[model samples]
Target: MAANSPEGATPRESRSWTLRLRRAIDQHLPMGHLLPDRQPYYVGSWVYVFGVITIAALAWVIVSGVVLSFMGPQWWHDSRLGRFVNSLHFWSVQLFFIFMVLHLWGQYFMAGWRHGRAATWMIGVVIFAVSILTAFTGYLTQQNFDAQFIAINAKDAMNSAGIGAFFNVLNFGQMYGLHVMLLPIGITFLVVAHIVMVRARGVVKPIDAEGARS
Candidate 1:
């Protein structure tokens, strides 16, 4: 007859969990959350690995970026090892974007954005936007003919968009540090945060009560 009771046994069972936690703490006993016995959480979707592959690609980008950073900007253009690392970094970026785009698309179709998972999806979209901006800035900092051309072409659009006032695209020095350091750090943190949220909430199952299997 409790006001909070919808189904008596179900509410009582839920409340019992809280009391057990309290007792465990009072008695200094180890307590853990009961994980669902759902098998739907890790359905054999290859798309599941797409997001992970993107993370792995980002890791490669970071490693190559670090090597290139120690060599400095000019060294990449002048030295064989530096140039090879730069190419590796460039390819890693391409791979990261490819995998992430696919992951996002797959999530959308799978309706992985359902439940309380909307926040996770929104945060991920923002991270994707940031990564794109980082990539553009990265391409601008190469200081090669391609970089010069892009800087010239992209300069006006940025100025028109008001971003040019805050950032000087022509400044390879600043862009270099931002690409290899600041933005990479930001992207890495975002990915880690996203993964934490995913693991904490667990994967959502589709409609038709299939989540019970999950």
Candidate 2:
């Protein structure tokens, strides 16, 4: 049959990720508005620096978390090296959230969401909330009695609110996967997307004329 017609054309193959991404941009970015030649007028010294620092803190959290996770919960609690590494991971998490909050607050103080950017800001806020919830879940995933005790206590709070009937924080399998994989993936993607939007739009100007100029 003509050499099987070159494997039946292989269904013409789907578009690549880059091509698909470009197509999506073309669809949504309004053409020329996708990029601007002129620099953003409001970028005063270190106006955009917090975004970079926040991202780096997030990176540290993920890298250290991955290494610590491999040490296993038993190793983490039992061995000195594992404990130190685990502690580093924990503190990095704290720093990640701290930096993220500061970064968002800085943007807010500058009124950075004024120019058709509210949707992006909302996404960033949601990511922040999710990250906090994920951190709580991380504490619940420790497998130690402390995790169980905290889970039970929180379950009481959640039960009073009527949600614990659905979610069992004591479920280590679910909590671990959600904390390590799901939340990290969601947070990282949202952070990266938020950053891309910020870069494309530039930091917002200050309200006062002199501040904007500076």
Candidate 3:
């Protein structure tokens, strides 16, 4: 401990996990940065809004999906209330994908990978890919003819590729578990990670700054 340190304070090298975590939080996400009322002027572009819209849609999707899971597929197809909720979840998915694609394209052309932000860019890409798989699993859990047909058709290909045993889409229970339990958790994790990384690095500079950096 330094001479000026408090009596019980641990040295930096051997700090407790709790202290380390608090330090990391302060270092990476100071209060103003974490919930800023202002951002760089370049972020004013219309394209920047799509990323937040995509996240909003995802939040709605998850809320509606949780309700749908409790009610189950039969209720969704038969009950008016359930159908309304199902529509919310479905449309939210569509909006999520639409905004996500637009955001991805906008970010890519802006060279979002610049300024030591490669991991942030890669994580965004992974989130997009994983979100598609999550949506596919959602479709498979719908318990409709479309789901049955898709599962049956895809299972053959999955097996030929030697992965069907592990990811047996034909099994309604497996697909349901994945959609309701596993994949949602994964998407939630990736979303959290992407948001944290964004806050840690700050947004990428505008494309014009790219050439100037060179």
Residue 165 of candidate 2: its Cα lDDT?
73
lDDT of 2 at 201: 55
Q: Is candidate 1 or candidate 2 better by lDDT?
A: 1
- Cα lDDT of all candidates, in order? 0.78, 0.73, 0.84
What does the lDDT read for residue 147 in candidate 3?
Answer: 94
lDDT for each residue of candidate 2 in 64-149, tens digit (9 for 90 to 100): 78887776657888888888888888888888877788878887887777766786788788988988888898999887788989
- Give lDDT tens digits, candidate 1, residues 88-188: 99999999999999999989888887777787898799899999989998899888899999988888998999988878788787777788778888888
Output the better candidate (2/3) by TM-score. 3
Q: Number of the top candidate by lDDT?
A: 3
Least accurate 10 contiguous residues by lDDT in model 3: 1-10
Ranking by lDDT: 3, 1, 2
Evaluate residue 37 in candidate 1 and report its C-alpha lDDT on the 0 to 100 scale. 51
Candidate order by TM-score, decreasing, is: 3, 1, 2
Off by over 4 Å in 2: 1-42, 208-214
